[model samples]
Target: MLLFQLAFKYTKSQLQRPSYWLAVLSFALAISLMVVSLLVISAYEKTFEKSITQLLGQIQISYLSPNISLPKVLSYLQKEKIKVAKVTSFIHQEALLVKNGKVKGVLLEGLPAFEKKASSFFLKKTLNNTAITNFSKDRYGAYVPVLLMKDMSLQLGDAFSAVVAKSMGKNDFNRKVLKFYVKGVLDFGRSDYNRRYLLTSFEALQKPLKLSKKKTSGARLWLADKVFSEELSFKIQKHFSSKLIAQHWRQWANNLLEATKSQKKMIFLVLLIILIIAAFNIMSALFILIVQKTKELSILRVAGLSVTSIYAIFSLQAVFTGLLSLTLGFALGYLWAYLFLLIQSRYFSVLSQIYKLNHLKIGLPLWDMLIIIAVVLFLVLLTAIIPVYRAGKNSLPEGLSHEL
Candidate 1:
């Protein structure tokens, strides 16, 4: 109890030093910036993943070998009924779309006209078109991305021909021309996907490609929730054994994930450097406090206070400073994040120009918050240790006799 009283008194005295306030402000600023940057990166990664998963199903199942028998694939799918949610087959092929004597390479995707699980954002966008009411009946009508339509100089109701390549018995290429009407145009917010992709009902490509009703390039596996994608993918692979290749959305966008991860790592490294610099400021502040309190510490020692008690006093002072800074920093950081979100949403276009993002996004993961608190506490303790040790070692007469 006596030691605790001395510790409290020392802590109060340390607060009077100008160096203490400077250290607190510096540490707070560094932490706020680091937290905001982390939140922004995390939110962007999540949004990008959601966009990709909406366009492509959570998991995709394809033939492992080059041309597996259709019956074998169906048999494996039947066996995995419990794990599968909704299985929709699709045909993906590259074709040259020609208009006005100009040709552009396009990825043609053939899916069912009426998708039962049409709640996805991409599906909603596709269905918003007013041109074609019944996609099933309009076998010749097709949907093209807005960028592709512009590149091909295609207008509503305009007709375009697609030349599809076919593989014969030998290593040969055969060409088949199919006419298609422009029914709708879409924009997926990605320039590359929008510029080279075309969407059509299953019946449109089946006849031209000479594929049976049961055969498709691949099958998309939609789970009840996006969270089950990884588990479902593993189940699918085990059920299919060697007959099929199972991949989740993460695998489909491997490059994007890798890039995001690398960028996050770099940001973390930069933040760590900032934190170290802040910690150095804390060390300097504590050292200054030690010099200022040398005489007081010596007086406390002369009044029957132990060296350990003196050490604890300075350590408690440092901890209190860190905690106070942490509290203020978190509040300011979150306020900044909320305000930025509001501003971006209100003036999205202008903000997009400034940040290269459609809007401000911030995601504060609980783990990251805990990590920040732990790091701050650790740094505070580390910076306090040396100064506390020096204060504890001061001779009673020598320290008290020194002039400020």
Candidate 2:
């Protein structure tokens, strides 16, 4: 009781100084910066992961053998009893597009109709979210992303000519010009999708690629448990023959994921450095306070309080300061993080286009918050230990003889 009262009184006295407030501010800023950075990075990763998985599925089963049929691989998957959400077939080819005197090279994506199983899976948000997909039912129709239209100066209902390579001899090829009408314009927000992708139907694509009903270049498999994508991929590789290769979605979005991970690490390192400096500020403040209060501590020791009890007074002050900082810092961090998220969602859609960020979301990761708490508490404890040990080491006689 005596020690706590002394601790409370001491903390109250220290609050009068501007340095104390500055230390608390530093702690709060550091916490807010780190928490916001962590939450933003987490949200980007989740959003991008969803976009890529929806487009490529959790696992892609691609085979080099032209003789391998989709039905055969599906039957094998069924026999293995592997849980799946959806299976889709995809075919893509590089072609030159000409419209309005503008010639641009683009990747043409051929999938089944929107009503069919193979189509753009943009992760529909609502029943009425028609813009999530721009697949046209007409075999002669093409869906163009709006960003690409701007680049090519194309509008809806315009004619697009694709220069596709067709096999003439066993090793020679000829360029076949195919014409189609623009069906719709898309605004999917991903850079690759906007700038490079042209949506076409399977019926239209098969004529050029010479693909039969049973054969496709690659098959996409969506799992009921997306978190186990890597595990399922490994299992597929082990069970399937050397001709079949399974790749996880991360492998497809490697560049994006790697950039996100690297940015996160760099930002974390910067914030951690800031927090360490803030902790050092606390250390300095506490040391100064201990010196200023040495006479009071000497009086207590002279009045028969044990050295341990005198040390307890300072240690308890540190605990109090640490807890107070933790509460304030967490509140500030949460506020800043959500506020930034709100700002981004409400106002930064254009900016997101500049960065190729699509389907960005706001999410709070509990494990990350827990880690921040643990780190802050550990630094607080370290800050307390060094000063308190110094206080405890002062001889009773020396304290008693000290001048105020």
Candidate 3:
């Protein structure tokens, strides 16, 4: 307790020193910089995940055949007690969208009118402005991406036509033009998805494509826990008897996921190098403090204080400094994150095309962040020990004879 008191006094005394404050500020800035970078990267990764999952679900069951029995697949999943959160069926076909004589090729997605999960792809902020209605209300209504709307010069309630293919024979193909009204506009973040994707009702597309009411291209399954996607996909394929194949989104989006991870590792390496330099700066400050107090330490030694007690006092002082710096750093980092999020919310739409995110959100698991902070603190203590140990080794005569 006495040694801790002495350590506290020495730590407080150093607060008035410019060199000590410089060390603290440097370490704090490094911490805040790392926190901000990590938060932004984490946000980007989550946005990518949401965009992919919104389009593909966690797992997709597809067949090359014109259609599959959606009820049978749903029953099979129920019979197997699969951990499915939501299942949405869709029909995917290539079609040509035409407006005012301008034609563009697009991927048409036919979603069931009852699947409210399909609304996930819509940018909610624009829903009020555009008056997005349910497909159930308007069977002939279509949802077009924002980019497609711009390219085709389309507006809500505008009439358009989709030229779909209907094969009349093995070698001959026929074209069927289906008219639709623009019901809503969507923003899926990625320019590719935004440019070429369109949505309509399953029945509206099924009849036009010469498919029966019981037919669909595929079903998307949202799992209770996505970590089990690969395992569930295998089980689904095994149960389907080759008529349908299940694929997890990770299969197609692996490159994006791997890139996010690699970028995170690169950022961490750069921040670690910065942290090491800051730690060395703090070490130098503490070393200088020990040198300046040599005579004071020698007087304490003469009064019967042991070298071990001297070492403990200095270690305590370092612990206090490290803890204080970390606290200030965390406060500054979170404050900045909050301010950035608040300010960026207003302009997210302008940035969404480039960043592929409709909104910016910051999330880092608290336990993981704590573990990182602990590792940093451990490194600081390890570095602090070197100077503390050297100070403890100073002989009584060497410390006493030093010029005051």
Candidate 4:
């Protein structure tokens, strides 16, 4: 109880030092930097995760292998208790999109949603097209990406040609040139998709590619949620033959997912280093305080205070200092983060458009953040031990006769 009195008195007397205010400001900035970093990185990761989900379904079934008989797949899908929400087949093909002296290769996706005559019209309008409707009836219609429009100088109602073939060898005699009507443009926010993709309904690609009405390249399976898909994906792999490949988005967007995780971890490490440097600043402040109070501590020792009590006084001072710094830092960090988010969300919408960023979330999973903050606070408080030892180890006569 007496130790608390000395700690409070000492801290109050030391508040006149400019170094104390500097320490508070430094620690506040460091903590705020960490908080903002966590929020931005988390939001960035979530955007990419959503992009992955849209591009690749929860699970995919590929029928490329010849041994993958259709009967086994149908039977497996018919089993009860499977949490299958929807399964849609798609026609994925690599085709050459040739326009006025500019040619680019793109993945042409044929989806069932584009089955009707009015589907292309909606695709055009949604892809930032000024034109209202598509030109073709049952003929080939292609919705190119925005990247293609800029590079190829394409326009709605324009005519273009697509070469759909396995090989580039013109002498092989299997290549087919299918002319198409420019229906619209697409922008899914991912640069890869916006630059190298074209959309067509299954009907549009059927006559051009010579495929059966119901046949498709592969099927996309969506489960109720991501949690159920993992176990379901494993079950799909175990129950299905090796000839057929059953996969989830992790397998489909493996490179993207790996990159996002790595970037997040790297950002976290950088934050940790900065926070540690702040702790070091606090350590220096404590050492200076103990040195400045050395004579006062000697007087206390002369007045019947034990060495243990002296040490406890400094320890209590450190705890109080850390608590005060934390309070100030939390307030500063949240205010700064709020202002930053406001500026970013309002002024940098172009970046959001390019990157497909949704609302920025600030330090979600509040309990986990609380745990990390607690651990960091504990570590900072430990820095007091060094100064406490140095100030309390000397005898009463030695402390009283200090030169300074």
Candidate with maximal lDDT: 3
Q: How far out, in Å, is residue 36 in model 4?
A: 4.9
Put down candidate 2 lDDT per residue, 143-184, tens digits, no spaces.
Answer: 777678789988666667888887788999988776766666
Give the per-residue lDDT of model 1 (tens digit) for 219-288: 7766766686787688768866887888898886677678878988898789878887888888788788
Give a tens-digit lDDT track for model 4, residues 1-404.
78899899878876788898788678767776766666666656665666556655778777766556445665676674666666677788888888877778888888787635334222445322344254454446667767677777887667888878854356663667777777666655565666767777887778766778767777777766568776777787787657667787777557755877797678777877887778777778888888777777889888888989988888888777777776776677667777887887677765456444434556535753685478567757777778789888866677677665
Candidate with top TM-score is: 3
Model 3, 1-404: lDDT tens digits are 99999999988899999989999988888888778777777877777777778888988888765545777877877897877888888888899998899999999899887235446777422234244453333247677888899999998777788898888899999998887777677888776788898887787787767687777788998988888878888887887767888898778768767988898889888988888788887788789889988989999999999999999998888888888778877777777887877777675555465565656667865754886588568867888898999889998999999984
List CA RMSD, all candidates.
5.7, 5.3, 3.9, 6.4
The parts of candidate 2 lying over 4 Å away from their true place are 1-17, 36-44, 79-81, 113-139, 172-179, 207-211, 234-245, 253-270, 288-320, 323-364, 390-404
When 1 and 2 are scored with TM-score, the better candidate is 2
What's the lDDT for residue 296 in model 3? Answer: 90
Alpha carbon lDDT of residue 172, candidate 2?
Answer: 100
- A best-first ranking of the candidates according to their lDDT comes to 3, 2, 1, 4
Worst 10 residues of 4 by lDDT: 120-129
lDDT of 4 at 306: 90
Instruction: Evaluate model 2: give its TM-score.
Output: 0.74
Assess the local accuracy of residue 29 in candidate 4 as a C-alpha lDDT between 0 and 100.
75
- For all candidates in order, the CA lDDT equals 0.74, 0.75, 0.80, 0.71
All candidates: TM-score: 0.69, 0.74, 0.83, 0.67
RMSD of 3: 3.9
TM-score of 1: 0.69
Candidate order, TM-score descending: 3, 2, 1, 4
C-alpha root-mean-square deviation, candidate 1: 5.7
